[model samples]
Target: MRFCELTEQEFRDFSSTHELHSFFQTPEMAKSKQEDGCNCYYVGVKKDNKILCATLLIEYKGRLFKTFSSPRGYLIDFRNKELLNFFTNGLKKFISKKGGTILNIEPKILYKERDMNGDIVDGGFDNSDIYNNLIDLGYKHNGFYLELDLKKQVRWAYILDLKNKTEEQVFNEFKPNTRNIIRKAIKYGIYVRELSLDELDIFKQLVDSSGELKNFKSSPLKYYQKMYRTFKPLDQIKFMVAELDLNEYSLCLNKELEEYNQKISKLGSKSDSKKKEYQTQIDVLTQRLEDLSVKRKGGDKVILAGGMFILYGKEIAYIFSGTSTKFRNFQAQYLVQWEMIKHGIYNGYNTYDFYGISGDFSKDNKRHGLYEFKKSFGGNVIEYIGDFDLIISPLKYFLKKLISRFGGK
Candidate 1:
């Protein structure tokens, strides 16, 4: 096998058809990263002029030495130990020749096949061999992390498989409460629409607030702008916002209240259980109407939730999103998800990736809410093979880590 740098077209052609293809591994993403002041290049290992594996390498400068990262790296067969070793050796030499000291990698390979509840299937497919192969190739494992770590690529994800399933089938598989929330969002005039370029600031505001609450860094407006400029035209990225119009919502709510009252005042055969159900909904709707009145005093329309998505190849990735706390009870976020899920299903995509969640399944975990939100859409948890660092230049790698307080990975 021969390892060499590949042209953008060459990389794109091979990556688009790879079994492990993802948006992150695309030339478009590489160009987007370059726009963000990062250096990127395409590299591949070839046999008899046939591309066996390839990667889009992203380079970041540190205080001391430059660090190279292969975000969802090496579109290669992990089972091929020979190919992995050859690629690692060639990559290490190639990067070490430059000022690079560390080569960071986070493969998208699944670590274990886990159920919806996050428990490993007793005899499910395991990739410990792949992890071991990587470790054996002189890459240092970052260990299994349970809590949310936004600094690195996601080591865990939630994916809804839409293949060979009708839209109704997929919708019915969602948790009952989840479906109810989605329906409630729609009934309340919460609608999802793609955001225009000028509308990113509105999404940025929500991201800032959500980041603060979750204790993670949020992308700046420029980052979104650059990404939009680079990927939007290629039909690879989408920004969606959920909106609420108080006037229409109020009309709908009033009609719903009248219907409930009519049912409660039926002349005969009223069960206590049915009455209690009607009363519960009436009380909730009344409070929402009151809140709507207050919000209407401020404005007729409001953005309740915003999200950024990566639409590439066979998948639609819900990459980043935020929601307005004031409309938390309205469950606008649920509608935002349903919007994209339906899009993915109708567009012939095979997967809807609800990206990033805490690996810790414990209810007491602070990040458990993220897991629950993703889980409610009826998808299994994916614990990915986590981050690994290949020390290209040991001395500079340690020096850079020391200066950054070990944040280089």
Candidate 2:
């Protein structure tokens, strides 16, 4: 087999049809990274005029030596040891000649099957051979990480398999609480709609608010703007926002209040017990009306949550999301996710990926709440094989690590 550089179209044609294709491996993603100061290369192995293995490697120039990364890539059959070895050997040589110190890869292959509760499945498919093969081929195995820190790609994700399933079937699979929350969100007049590019600030504000509340930093508005510009033309990305129609909610509440008033009027001469029950109903409705009045006084519509999704090949990935703390009880975030899931099902996508969750499942873990929330949607927790580094220049790689550790002090 001969390794060669492929044109953008040529690489896209092959990768899009491959079962292991990810949005991160696309030419558009490469172009976006290029704008961010990385040099992108699309390389493939061909034999008998057919592409075998392919990857989109990005070269990041550092002060000491350059580093290469293949994000969730190397679209290949890991089970085929000979083919993988050939690709790695050629890739290492290619990067070494280009003055790269290390080549990092975080393949999309699963380490082991994990259930929704984050427990390993007994007798499930294991890719220990693939893991061993990389180590044997001279790549260093980064330790399995349960935290979401210090990793290129997230080590864990939640995926809802929508294959051959109807929307109702998928909805029914959700936990009872999740379904109730979605229902409540809808009942509260929360609706989701696609945001045009001009309206991206709404999403940015939501993310910024969430970041501040959670004490995490969010990317600048221009970053999302860049992504939208990059992927929107291909219909490969969407930004959706969940909003509450306060006017409509208020109208509904007023109508309910009118019905309660009529019931009380009709019970003018009823028994004292019946009168008390009607009074109690009226009181509850009146409180709800007052709350609705207060909320609607601000504006006719208020954004409660928003999310950005990436669509590529067969999967729709929920890449980023945030919710308004003020409407937490209404559960607008749940509604946003349900909308995306329904979109995937109606559009015939194979999977809805609730991307990125800390692998640490213990309740004490800071991100455990996120894990539970995603798990409530009834999907498998995927633990990937994690990151591996192919050292091309040992001295350069060592020096870089040494400087990084000591800050060159």
Top lDDT model: 2
Assess every candidate by TM-score.
0.93, 0.93
Model 1, span 28-112: residue lDDT tens: 8888888778899899899999999999999987555688999998899998999999999989888987779889898989999
Clashing pairs in 1: none
Candidate 1, TM-score vs. the true structure? 0.93
The Cα RMSD of model 2 versus the native structure comes to: 2.5
Error of 2 at 156 (Å): 1.0
**Residue 98: error of model 1 in Å?**
1.0
Model 1 global lDDT (CA atoms, 0 to 1): 0.88
lDDT of model 1, residue 241 = 91
Task: Please give, for residues 23-134, the per-residue lDDT of candidate 2 as tens digits.
Answer: 9999999989988999999998999878899999999887767999999988999888899989998898899889999999999889999998889999988989999988
Off by over 4 Å in 1: 263-284, 405-409
- Per-prediction backbone clash count: 0, 0
